[model samples]
Target: MVDRDRDKAAESRRILERISREADTGGASLVSRATKRARNHVSATDADQDDWIEQWGTRIGRVLGLAICVGLLVWLVMFLLRGA
Candidate 1:
C-alpha cells in the first residue's frame, strides 16, 4: 500500500509538471502575439496623436471640474434656502 501511494504521488507530480510547462509555453506565445499586434497598430507619428489626445484630455478635465464646482454651489444654495 505504501508503494502504491508513492507511485500515485509520483504520477501526479509528473502530470502537474507537464501541465505547468504547457501553460508557460502557451502564455508566452499569447504574449508574443499580442505584443506584435500592438506594435503593428502603433504608427511612427504617434507623438502627434499623443499631443492632441493630451490637449483633449486637459480640456475635458477642466470642463468636468467646472461642472462639479457649479453643481456643489447650486446644492449648497438650495440647502440654505430650504432652512431659511
Candidate 2:
C-alpha cells in the first residue's frame, strides 16, 4: 500500500513536470504578446534608466489627465445638483 502511494505520487510529479516543460516550449499567446507590446509602448524606458525627457513627459501627461478628470467630476456634480 505504501509503495503504491509512492508510485502514484511519483507519476503525478512526472506528469506535472512534462506539462510544465511543454508549456514553456509553446511560447507566448497572441493576447500576451499584444499586452507586452502595449506595456512597452506606454513606458518610455525601465525605471532604473535615466531618460529625463520621456520620464518628465510621462509625469506631465499623467498630471494633465488627472486635472481633466477632476474637472469633469466637478461639472458632473454641479449638473446633478442643479437638476438641469
Candidate 3:
C-alpha cells in the first residue's frame, strides 16, 4: 500500500511539472510572437499614399517631443543658475 501511494504521488508530481513547463513555454512563445509582430509593424518601410497624414502627424509629434525636452533642459539650467 505504501509503495502504491508513493508511485501515485510521484506520477502526479511528474504530470504537474510537465504541465508547468508547457505553460511557461506557451506563454513565452505568445509574448515573443506579439513583440516581434509589433516590432515588424513599427519598422516596416512600405508607405501608402494615404499615409501622408500619419507621416505628418509623426513628424509633428517628434518635433513637439524635442521642444518639450529642450524646454525642460532650459528650465533646469535656469534653476541651477538661480540657485548658484
Worst lDDT 10-window in candidate 1: 39-48
- On lDDT, the candidate that comes out on top is 2
How high a TM-score does candidate 1 get? 0.40
Candidates in order, TM-scores: namely 0.40, 0.44, 0.41
lDDT of each: 0.72, 0.77, 0.74
User: What's the lDDT of the predicted structure labeled candidate 1?
Assistant: 0.72
Show where candidate 1 strays beyond 4 Å: 1-50
Superior by TM-score: candidate 1 or candidate 2: 2
| Candidate 1 vs 3: which has more TM-score | 3
Residue pairs whose backbone atoms clash in candidate 2: none
User: Better model by lDDT, 2 or 3?
Assistant: 2
Residue-wise C-alpha lDDT for candidate 1, range 1-84, written one tens digit per residue? 999999999999999999988677554677798877554434323334558876566556666776799999999999999997
- Clash pairs (backbone) in predicted model 1: none
Total backbone clashes of model 3?
A: 0
Q: Using TM-score, give the best candidate's number.
A: 2
Candidate 1: residue 48 Cα off by (Å): 10
